[model samples]
Target: MAQDSARQAPAAPAAPARALLASFLPALAVGIGSSVLYLLMSGLAERLQEVLWGPLPDALGIGPYSAVWILVMLTATGVLVGLVVWKAPGHAGPDPATLGLTAVPLPVGTLPGLAIAAMLMLAGGPSLGPENPIIGVNVALAFWLGHRLAPRAPGPLWPLLAEAGTIGALFGTPVAAALVVSEALAGRPMRGALWDNLFAPLTAGAAGAMTTSLIAHPTFDLGLPPLGHPGWADLLAAVVIACAGALLGLTAVYAFPHVHRAFSRLGHPMLALPLGGLVLGGLGVLGGHLTLFKGLSEVKELAHDPGGWTAGQFAGMAVVKLAALLVAASCGFRGGRIFPSVFIGAALGLAAHALVPGVPETLGIAAGVLGMLLAITRQGWVSLFTAAVLVASPTIIALLCVASLPAWLLVTGRPQMQLKEDGTAIR
Candidate 1:
């Protein structure tokens, strides 16, 4: 709330302190409201997926994950998404290639088209997550409505609250929202009382988390056996797996612009997206349905039955998922890379453990996720947080914190997966 209340520049006496109390109601509303929309989006997509992949496949007498069916569905999804991009207002919202985790709100006009495109992407099975567009949608809605509802609040206030709320809903926890938002605000010069400047956003995050928990009960725990204690070898496993995952992610990061340009050369979303869908279908066929969709559920599936897959199968899954993420993002899909990356990391981690029995499986997973998120998102706190959450072990938490250090170094100066309009890395 004190975004502009630096002691050096502020003229209002006790105003910054007063802002905290004044902001609580609006923050709570934004949090709860954003969580509602988040859940609605997820529910709509889940229902569509059940119909498309479940009933319709059975009714049509085709295996949903069969190679032929996978290709058709993905390719068809691409075309449907292409039509949305070509015909929908705001071109189905901005090209995801040129965006980050959060941005200033888009026009309310763009929301419907963006929502449709994102839902199609989710239900239609391109290896991506709801996070990016969901945040965009929530932020846009909050900014648009908050102005009319709270005319006296700062212009930046609404989006921040919504962003925090959406993130909290996504993770079903205020911890993630706090870490991520605080990380973003860390270096910016701001005047504030000792109380968290992120009070309003944090409040919104708590509300959102509580709302999501009440409704969905989502969790990150992958059901991996606990890493009860750390040892020297376990630490080494964490370091090696994390660094390996980072390198693997960087390969995709470096290749991102090339893949985007390759699609860009096709000259239009209508032309490029279908072909991208075709590629994703092939990947899905190779990786199986377990590697499809946002990786959260897939990772859980993989974790539950680690022994069901061989080392080679796990390795193939990881590579295919990474390739699918690259193609999906490059080809104009509206989603985030984070969830898919999680799938890749889980696959890779399991592969590592399969190849070398000495590495503790939980430690391997935490480190692998730590590395992948580091290279992909480049958000240190969020990376560490996500990796630790997956295993839900206090011991792995400490191990991942140590694992993140060298892993961070590997990705620090490298190109991020995000790009500019010209298809170059944003850095």
Candidate 2:
């Protein structure tokens, strides 16, 4: 009887594996759920955009791409979002400028208003991505569902899983999630092996990436020249361009609080949002379509034919996009700043290439993106990954890594782009 019991008992070492396998199913479900939610939210916004910019304008007899229509649509979008924030449940959660990528799960009741506001921002040409708000919604939904469906699951694990899943879906790759989460979790002491904690999140990220891929493929490729063998000249140019981009990003960082304070002084969403919309509209008028939206497509457009634009034009686009980003963020638009910063960096890099003539287009762009992202995100690994991913050139990776050293130094002790609860800089 004793021998039989011993044979039946599970080995202690197998516990980790068993736990990981057990967590996998819930993680996968959460990932898929997050992706589904993302798709639904994005789809709704896309349809609304079509209506606002396409059929509605045509029906009203306004030219589809008219600046007047753009102005009207953006201003109206701000008003609608403001109304939701003012009257909707939970006041749309919290000010996005005060939040980061991760936060405590919000109440399920707040999701509706948050979703509405985010959708409006997306469709309205805000210079922000859907990452921040969508991640909050996903985390809340995942936690709520987990409690009902899997009572035994750890409470803390749900947020991590949800964040990983949403990040994977956002970038359409698990690698980005891994890098970001790893960077966030680095230096924090934990009980288990790092990989052990990472297993569930990675599983979730993979599921999310696969699910998002079924609906649409995410591509950052700009079709730039392949970064070939790097010479001494290329390295020198990379550092110079990277520093330049970092300086520009720092300028925005310094101006962010002032701009945010200016908008907040209105003391009412109704007053603040419309005024912000007006400023953004004016910026759009100055910068044209290339400076609109979250900037993914616009970055690609700018890179497609770098020679088509003058140095002055590229500089103008960068400045205008940075301004749009600041205004959209401060005015209660719920979105992420990464995409807009990436766009600004790309434009700055193109301008550098135009002026220097010595820097390769791909190298200059990678360096510029690295520097700006470093300043904006304050994450070296994520910044490096973002810059290298744009060109997908192995030759540029070494150059980017080296250039990031100086860029990091410049931004290390500087004020971050985020704001505190009291609307002060988070320095």
Give the TM-scores of the predictions, in the order they appear.
Answer: 0.96, 0.94
lDDT of 1 at 245: 97
lDDT tens per residue, model 1, 1-427: 4665575573755566576879999899999998999899989999999999989989999988888889999999999999999998888788898777777799998899999999999999999999999999999989999999878878988888998999999999998999888887876776664245789889999999999999999888887788876888888889999999999999999999999999999999899999999999988998888877887888888888887888899999999999999999999999998899988888899999889988777877888888999999989998889888999888787778888889988999889999977778975
Compared with the true structure, what per-residue lDDT tens digits does model 2 show for residues 125-174?
Answer: 87898889899999999999898888888898899999999988988888
Q: What is the C-alpha lDDT of each candidate?
A: 0.89, 0.88
For candidate 1, give the lDDT of residue 286: 87
Model 2 scores worst on lDDT over the 10 consecutive residues at: 183-192
Spell out the clash pairs found in candidate 1: 6-191
lDDT over C-alpha atoms for residue 416 of model 2: 89
The best candidate in terms of TM-score: 1
